[model samples]
Target: MTDFDIPSFLKTLSQRAGVYRMFDADNHLLYVGKARNLKNRVSSYFRARGLNAKTVALVSAIHHIEVTITGSEVEALLLEQTLIKEHRPPFNILLKDDKSYPWLHLSDHEFPLLAYRRGRRGGTGGKFFGPYPNSGAVREALNQLQRLFLLRSCEDSYFQHRSRPCLQYEIRRCSAPCVGLVSREAYQRDIQHTEMFLNGQSQQLITVLQDEMLDASSRLEFERAGELRDRIETLRLVQEKQRVYGTDRNMDIWALVEFQGVTCIHRLVFRDGRLLNSKNYYPDNLAGEEDPLLLLGYISQFYLAGHAAEGLPAEIIADIDSDEMTIVLDALRQQFDRSILHSRGVRGEPRQWRAMAEENARVGAQTRISGHQESLRKLERVSQLLGLDKAPRRIECFDISHAGGEATYASCVVYSEQGIASQRYRRFRIRDVAAGDDYAALEQAVERHLIRMQEASDLPDLLLIDGGQGQVGRIQQVLERLSITTVHLWGISKGETRKTGWEFLWAAGARQPIIPDAHDDGFRLLQLVRDEAHRFAISGHRKERSRSRGQSDLENLKGIGPKRRRALLLHFGSLKNMRGAPREEFAKVPGVSQKLADQIFAQLHGEDRSV
Candidate 1:
């Protein structure tokens, strides 16, 4: 079994209830389970003896684990079920449920019924929600519906035959439409709301419920308003169940996501109307971009060559919805010699499956795109995109920070293959430039840095500036005068909204910017470095600004001694007041002479004069 720092992880684990997810080396979610006491449950996995084959196999594949704390055991159970449905990990399938997952079935009748229906879902339903993790979850949902909607759960035959209000009606669990105690219109309104919630228009239904609640409160119907408020809360809990299920058995969904110049295609396998397995495939030599044709080619090779571990499904749904899928669909039919259903522009429940598949792809991509290996890989891709001989080992980004126009400072953040060369990171105190001039400030900082590089014979492979063409141009002129040509330059320009992953990238001497895909790894690397430089620069700027404001200018003046400077400050109250005072006001200080007053006056007012 792969070694896990179980002791260390358990030390940090809380005794609270929550869900823990196990993952393999590839970051594929291995298993998800809920616990009453998270620490005890997770600890039992590493008991060191008397484990079953399934447990041993699962543990062997486990590389790491993550946890999410919830309010209570019941909450953890619901969350566990949701996550299981969302990811459908392989190890979870090993522990089988005694029966098929339960669904909250609402019957089609004049007085509709909301009840739990297990086993087959479609053949005998009016409206169906869930395949909830357990029977308890379904029951809870049904109870909530009975409380809020007051719909009947009695069999149609009994409902039709009722002559008087039943126990359910007396207790406010049902509207008693069978007894004609409630109007058909009023009964139908409740049905409409239930339907709206099942259809995932929860916000729309909540709005109507709240508005009605407000109206009831305005009319002094406190009881009705209170009931409405309870309904809203119940609605939130029940609606947590995703409506992504369908009756389609043995289906496959392929979601391809390209992040940070890497392409990952995730395949979700559905067998016997259950999510059997979810896996991500990083096709070799994708070279950091997603092409529709390449995606189609991958799909062709994946299924046609019998690479599908679960075999060809009854239907294949892809993240793409372009006309190019037509060719692939036709090819799949010819290859398999059967009428296999292929769709991209899906609607209803299958649409949710498509969305779920894509979301899983993204999650998988994020896991694959993080950590030291991915960083090194990204640096290589960046070098390739920038047309460099090898991956740039040392990269730096520069940013300028100031308080409107004062206390200007510049930061140079360093990034190496091992990640953040913090020891090499440097911040410059920008001086001798006009207060508000950012261009001049940046120029001065870069010039000084380049001079240091020249002196030490050490230069960064790539230099990144957190500005548009103007800042890049300013830096270019500095490099030109210094005759430095070994370094590459990039400028990042943010949009007015300043959203991440959408910055316009400018390469020096290029006519147009290199605007790669929004989630491109190369672009993300630049954003990380730029953001780091901004952080360091702003922190330094704040400290420098505060330190400057705290000190008196008289301390830096050569001619003024401590005692005389103190007397002048005491008389004037502040440097601002003293700067405005004339030579006569300076001599008014008890310790100052007339001659020394002229010198003090000239220095205080920044006016050069012969003393």
Candidate 2:
């Protein structure tokens, strides 16, 4: 690790277009940027004027610098985006939830397969039609295409093993390629028609289908002609449905709205002149940057290869325009290898689309604000009923779950009035306590949780446990031994009938139970917290029980240790598969000896004897 002297590094920097990478003391990338004059841009951080707090922190953390010179500003821009995506630095304002966009894959096969794909490993030799804005839109397109083309959606494995036409063929959604019901040439023609439809050539596809239908009719191929006629009708319907967008323009429209430091962004994707999909995003950790700069950062990070699995359109419409627009456009154009029209404003449909996006952004922000306020209201009511110094901002609840005495587990769910605080939630695998002993398990879980939580401030203001006097009493003793006085404890006990809405609450050091009305907001909130804790605990217990059951079956075998057991499971994909495998398959596992394989096979196959 070389020590970076900022002033000396700036002096050595080239005064030409390039991209620069900054790393911290640990060699972790901190930021990536492109500039026409590399020296000027590199020096700006150390300029000692107009540097924001975030930039200053980034500069302070920098320990080393790397630069790659490019032939032009566009090339530098391209490199910068690539590096930013490859190493998503802490300082960059990245797009949220950009991965997992859907694509339409037309696989290369004897009969080409058409399906809605979420993610694919690079270069499967397929024609991928989109990075559609959402899965629903992709599904709708796939359904329409299936109805029109009758392409097979089955997997290669399923297709190979099929003995007869499946339900898809019966429903007329697939042409039954596996059963040879549809000829290769005919299926290929349908594939071509589908490709045209996806690529915005519906009118041309309709014309082609009509010609094919006429030719088939002349040759007295009534079945083939009728199929062609259906396809033409479907194509016409699709074309008519796209009339809302009103032009054959493919682009993306983006809008952003900021309120009280929180920002909401809406993205509208248009394909073949139709509003195909829309998505909303609310990115965190902006550090109070201006909206335009944030927008630029988002655009750069989003279109970069790390995030975008598919290429960008020739045009993009945005609600904000920044000085970085030229650089951003250059990067996109270079990567996509075509000129991009970045429309910031327009008069007609584009304006209407942008307006819709802006409205969505506003609605998204309002909804978030409403949720926060509702959380605060619930907290206020809780504080008043519980006689707290202030609203109980951090409330923690605990529950123990088990099936009989097996795989007992404890869960700690946290709430902070802003709804569930998932990050602070904790789960404990109950040890030391005997199974089915809820009281002992609860005690062990609370002690372990408190010991691990070092910070005094990290302790919850309110400790909620599921059970009556016994559970509450056990937790109180643990707190006393730890000498905790400020924190409060409460226990929820179900009434004699053991049902919802018939529950009593017990407070620490109070002999009488405090029962709030079922309709009371604070009481309802407590029920919610208790219910969430139970759900969390049950989920953990069930998973552990399942894993234990699997492990016990494998561990009991004489020749199988943990390592060999893992190797076998990994090879077969699961215990069920391994059980179903033939005796010869055991010898193929890496760690199993030939004799050991024979012993393992005998045991699994119920021919058990001495190893």
TM-score of each: 0.52, 0.38
lDDT of each: 0.72, 0.71
Separate clash counts for every candidate: 5, 0
lDDT tens digits, residue span 166-213, model 1: 999889998889878889999889888888887656666666776787
Please name the candidate that would achieve the greatest lDDT relative to the true structure: 1
lDDT (tens digit, per residue) of candidate 2 on 1-611:
23454543454355545567788888788887878778788888888699999888888898876665443454454345445555577787752233554678998888888988986649787788755535775687688789878999998988999999999998999999999999999999998888777776665555566667768989999998877765554443233222223457878878888743347877766666544444567877447677887877787788865454334766788866645677888887787677778888555456646755674565455344335455688788888878788888778999999989788899999877555665578899998777688889999999988866635457778899898887898999999988888778889989988877789898876777887787677777788789879878877886787698874556656778888876665445456555544344466567887578768865554431320
- Looking at model 2, report the run of 10 residues with the lowest lDDT sum: 236-245
The C-alpha RMSD of each candidate to the native structure, in angstroms, is 20.4, 21.2
Model 2 TM-score on a 0 to 1 scale:
0.38
* TM accuracy, model 1: 0.52
